[model samples]
Target chain A: MKMLFKGTEAIAEAAIRAGCRLYFGYPITPQSELTEYMSRRLPEVNGTFLQAESEVATVNMMYGASCTGRRVMTSTSSPGFSLMMEGISYMAGAQLPAVFVNVVRGGPGLGDIQPAQSDYFQATKGGGHGDYRMIVLAPHTIQEAVDLMNLAFDLADKYRMLVTILADGMLGQMMEPVEFHEMRDLRDMPQKEWALTGASDHKPRKVTSFDIDPYELEKMNLRYQATYKKVEENEVRYEEINTKDADIIVAAYGTMARIVKTTIRMAKEEGIKVGLFRPITLWPFPYKRLNELADTVKNVLTVEMSYGQMLEDVKLGVNGKANTPFYGRSAGVVPTPTEVLEAIKKIMVGDLNGR
Target chain B: MVDKAVDKVIARMPKSLSGKEFTYCPGCHHGIVHRLIAEVIDELGIAGKTLLVAPVGCSVFAYEFFDLDGTVAAHGRAPAVATGMKRALPDRIVFTYQGDGDLASIGTAEIVHAANRGENITTIFINNAVYGMTGGQMAPTTLLGQKTTTTPYGRTVKANGYPIRMSEMLSTLEGSAYIERVMVTTPQNTIKAKRAIKKAFETQIKGLGFSMVEVLSTCPTNWGMTPIEASKWLEENMTKQFPLGVYVDKTKGGN
Candidate 1:
């Protein structure tokens, strides 16, 4: 059965279906509806929803919930996500599993509440301090958002690492048709042996991020590196659209990918052979696939809502094989399909060739 | 041969304690406070169900000494972490151990709001006059006219703000079910401190509300005083600034 839902509400309901019973978050724009939805729905399912005092506290609360070996999540926008960096780092260091949703807004400082993909670097790279990586999934539609929310919890638990849903404000606020999956049984999930359930059934456990001894810390870092390597090898995902026989290919993710899809359609009508490569998993970015596509495509156009953030990755993936051009709008500006198509045309016509 | 009569235990570590030596300095009150909490947990028979949220000050590694499921929280965020733990596992007993720097300064917002929300958790706050872990820096509880590394010439009211009486301040909040300031300066005072710790946990077990025991602890190493003198200094000076008493006890009114 198909149900229409805002991107924010879909993610919230998906989390419930995914057996995430504990949620801790502070109110932030573009994502407040997610929190508000959880507040009303969580209790009906006997789940806990706590609106924390601040983003700092909310993330720490997530850390606490995560330590109990429970599925937990929080959603916020850009500025609030910045406040959660420290807690995110702590969770990473402790090797706890939790999900974070970033309904990204404009950046640098207190940017407007409109949609922007400027947090690409902060999300794909470690937003917090230290050498750590989160599994970042970018969903273009509300339906994809629902499906990814279910997968996110499993991936977080599978790797014992943080997982992030990177969505733009437009995707968060937009309404679309979504199909909710069946509820997952909490008992069917894998047991967390390291969790601090209690001391009665087993030896006392201490979940901590502190390691004073340099050698011990190094060993922990090596373990994390090994885990991330496995994730990179096993979890890279992306969607390919008409790249099999195309002269120009656009590289985008999330909302930008959706717009690029329209750009491809428009370009096709004009006899412009343009395709798209949409990265579903943004962190272990579909670099290998893009490298292959770079071999075949004549040129690549990187589209975003920021000043060429993901373009860096595109350039790396293209690896001098194809001419890579960039187009973006910053500070809460959403690029329309015509504008994106024009940029593609510019790249295809060699109008932006040398520079 | 008469079997050597097993002297009914003269002294032994509490069952809740892991039997590990604490790393605190000789005169540090953290050892005393840890013992009191362990004893309370043991007596209440909740050691098996207790979860401790350790803080990032001197007691940052407190999980090592307690034989209970615990997690070491980030600096000054123990209350927030504990709030999450208790809320998630409502059947389990959760508590936080924090210091002056961790609780009164960086964690002020967490503690205040946790209290306001009346989270069903207990807090054991150790308020030394200075930041012991960072080497004698002034703390939010530092007494005026008291000299320390940060306040070399003496903490002056003109320059620095007056010491915060957290127990008194927290008592004003409606969500706080129990708030008391106790010290372990003497044997009698240690007993009173243990009693206060017990009552704090009892409040939580009863599902009352937020209960906290603010311990007026001594830091001999930081204060540049002998272990003996630190006790006297705490009793003479610290207690005057932070009066030793129960500011709020909701159970007293049978609430």
Candidate 2:
């Protein structure tokens, strides 16, 4: 049905329609709407929805429900997501598949419940432990919020990877039009060989990563690294605009990326050739694609809702091929499209003019 | 007929066990509790289908001894991990083997709420009144007047404090279906411990609710005593502080 839904609600609805049977979560600001949405909708489809005592409990519940091969999910914000780190680490170690939605807020420690991209490092750099990686999707708008959540579940199950849907408070709180889908049946899905549901007489199944020998653990970590490489090779995803002949390129993600889209359009109108590269998958990051763009663009300016977190990746992608600069706003202040356009103008002409 | 019954009862244990002898110190009650859990798994014939969650204590390497599907959890977080395991495979038998330090100290919240929610799982709690895994240290169950490395000059009532009665504490919750406190001081008590373990498993099989069996175990190495002396101490001092017998058994009231 066509209806205006908040980004958090849309993501929750998309998860519900993706045959998700269990939703465990603790309420937090900028994302409580998602839990509220699930609380109302999950029961209608005979699904389980639990408001866990805390974020820690919610994630563990997600771990438990996911073990049964049920499509399970949890939603929380920055501080809540921090509490869930231990569970996330266990999920990765167990090779369990589940979706986690982090509606990002400013934080070193509960900085504010407002929108922030400060979790860039935590999400993309293996937030928990034990040499593991999770599939992280950065959604820029309400539509992408719904779309990425479904894709998150799909990637999680297919790769036995923990998938994270990361959006900041802006997208989570903003309302936009979205079309919902009827839930799909998981019965026809490929059988999960690693799950401990039950061992038939045919063969016994086991799920663990407790080998104590250093060499064995090294080999297990090597396998995980190889799988991460494959994901990086096969799953690098992004959106590009006006890159055919551009001197300056702007890189951003999530809420900032969406704002940069409009900024790029305005930059083009001003006769200063600037393009936009918005990464969709923050982990298995679109480095190769950005590297290719770096060869063509004169300078790359990375913008974000936090202080220059993603700029480091932009520089890594460019690798001295292009001049990389950053503009950011932290502590709950979201930069406008005009602010980004102005920053681009200053970078193009303010210093090292036309270099 | 007596020989036949005896033969059936004295059968060999399951092959799913890791076969490595346990690393627990002599006079430690972990071995007795482990044997009891193994016997219960044997009797139920669910060892093949059971997924055991081991805690980080002296028994962290329990996965090495139990011949079944087992995973080791972070200290005190075994219940949290078991919660996931049980939810994932509701049909499979899932149980967490944890210690007093691992459960009552850092993981108290997870265990309490999981029980309060009536999660259909089994928790085998080994209360040794001290932390045996990490040198001799005072545990939440460490009795007043009991001394350890962390509690010098004995655990004072006003200072180091009284021992926690987990079985009594957990039995007060409405969602808990079966809560029993058993002692493994002798072979006769060991048999009763096995029965408690079996009942906790049966509760899950019947989809009753949360079940826990807290075993009063000895830690002779940590207590600076021989294995026999530790068992004797458990009989004299430990039993008086943490009494044996079921604190709460609600299987008849359960589904």
Candidate 3:
């Protein structure tokens, strides 16, 4: 049942297979196909599909549905995702398990419908209030979009944490071949010990973020910090290409990463020993891998759709060990391979000048 | 047959829920409304099967009062939360309790759309003419020429706004399966209010569609009077603007 589909549809199909029985969301550009696909498919399987009146309502619905131990999800673009911040904070605070997909578009606010990676800071820094972090997976291709969604659900259930699939609008709109997996057996899935299912004689399970006691809230914060420590230690994932003995490395993610892969190949043809480091999980940020690459690579050139947001992390990873330069294209434009190759040449010249 | 069902439901009220004590100021209708819902949940034997989504305003702390699985929603978003709860667990009885300012002002879109979508859920809306929690601010339901904090000069169509007849507005929508406006200001009306609540829940049980019972409530604190004065006020001025009695009853018609 392999078929060519848009990245958004691939994610939706993967979610349907992951026992995601409830979906509450609003339609937004670059990701509307995902909701449209769910509306057409969910009812056939007796799954819940609700087009919420607004993004704010949709996310709150996700909150309530998630509270009931159902595999719930919602998808939207940058602007819509912003409107969902309050509910996202609630989900994070309650330590609820839910999956959220952000097909990012340009903006600080309603910038444009075109593809953009400007939401990198918002996604990585926890888009909502209070002290919390969401497990963020960055998918470069359509196949990864499908694959990551299943993994997102599992990890969300396992950690009782919010999981996010962060992809740009271009990746969402582009068509690519995606592999499908066996449908997860809902009965075989683990039962949520914390969800509000019934009010029988057993101990009542309260699903809430409110803690009037300072000590209890403090303990919750420490637990979250400890959890993030474990995620940083065990959950960091990335891809390496031509870094075996390469002199220069180009770090990117999502569409920019794919473009960097092609640019590295072009650079190699031109007798420039360039490599690529594509971070798959942007939240755990793959700092250790970047540190390892810094030991061998003389220069690291970071590229993205937004103007140098992730480059800051690359700099921290390099930690003054190498000369790291950033190149960015903004306002609905993706950087082409030629542009990245040109940036690589500039970085190489800068590297030679330092010698 | 109706009497039997009501008696069975009345028997299941949890002891944890105070059988009589209430913090709602005297003549305030919230105590009556909450009691009716708790009684109905008990009567239907759905106390354990129901998830009560509570709204902000006076009922913000309803989680403390209701013995059922309760979730607190932000202002005006209780219906959205209840919609999510209902869709996620089709077997559970999910309902939202909201006040006029919460439902009509901030949450109007959510309530209207949830009903229009015919979501399998119920809404218990309490319409008190003045905003009680925020100190007697003029609410969406504040009648013309009514005076309050912001409308000290009286709610004027020329200066302030007209009262919103929410139940009637919602009854006109095709998505409304059972829409009723009841008053809890008197015992006779209290019986009608309970019947409406029971009918709304039954509609959810049948999986018919969206059902709502808008209860005309009282706010003595905001009305510059005692609980008795507020109840009398509700019977007098508020009823003239909001009105009572069932706007639409489709329970027998089966949606």
Best by DockQ: 1
Error of 2 at A157 (Å): 2.0
Runs of candidate 3 exceeding 4 Å displacement: A201-204, A211-223, A295-298, A353-355, B1-27
- TM-score of the B chain in model 3? 0.91
Off by over 4 Å in 1: A351-355, B1-6
Q: Residue-wise lDDT of candidate 3 within A216-293, one digit each (tens)?
A: 989988887888888888888999898888868889999889888888788878888788899999988988889988
lDDT of every model, 2 decimals: 0.92, 0.82, 0.85
Docking class of 3: medium
TM, chain A, every candidate: 0.98, 0.95, 0.97
Between candidates 2 and 3, the one scoring higher on TM-score is 2
Off by over 4 Å in 2: A202-204, A350-355, B1-10, B14-18
Q: Which lDDT tens digits does candidate 1 get at residues A222-311?
A: 999999999989999999999887878889899999988888888889887788899999988878999999999778888999999999
Error of 2 at A300 (Å): 0.3
Interface RMSD score of candidate 1: 0.6
